[model samples]
Target: MAVIATPVDATLQVVVQTGTDDGGRPVTRVRSFRNLKPSAVDDDVMAVAKAFANLQAHPVDSIVKVVEIALTEEQ
Candidate 1:
């Protein structure tokens, strides 16, 4: 009989970027969250879904929201 083994992965840094508001103000804010998963797809999907759900439930118009960013890790 043979056994299969799997390797572990490091944590990821999720950087969320947002746009400026209609008031001509810059939203200088940086938020980071940690995930202990090997794949990025799962984390991204959940984050997007949650954000959308919150916006739908609250029904508020925020001038800025998470638009795009890079996914990397911190040493």
Candidate 2:
């Protein structure tokens, strides 16, 4: 049998490590960007994530990781 690829939506989970919060505990912010190309590579996406994250208002925070997620269409 032939293989069929299911259509999916791609998103990047940008995790940023922010400074300690009011409680003096480490904090993290997760931002999701949807509609990315399914062919996007981790390196490429990470580059973009880093650049975008750097330009964000939260300058004190540093990008920890960029995770790609795909949601397949359901019949």
Instruction: Provide TM-scores for the models.
Output: 0.26, 0.55
Cα lDDT tens digits for candidate 1, 9-61: 43433333354688976544333333444444655655754565464423323
Model 2, TM vs. native: 0.55
- In candidate 2, what are the lDDT values of residues 1-75, reduced to their tens digit? 444464455776666666678989878787777787767776888798887877766643443333345445445
Model 2 pairs whose backbones collide: none
Error at 40, model 2, angstroms: 1.0
Q: What is the lDDT of candidate 1?
A: 0.42
- Give the C-alpha lDDT of model 2: 0.66
Which pairs clash in the backbone of model 1? none
Worst 10 residues of 2 by lDDT: 59-68
What's the CA error at residue 27 for candidate 1, in Å? 2.9
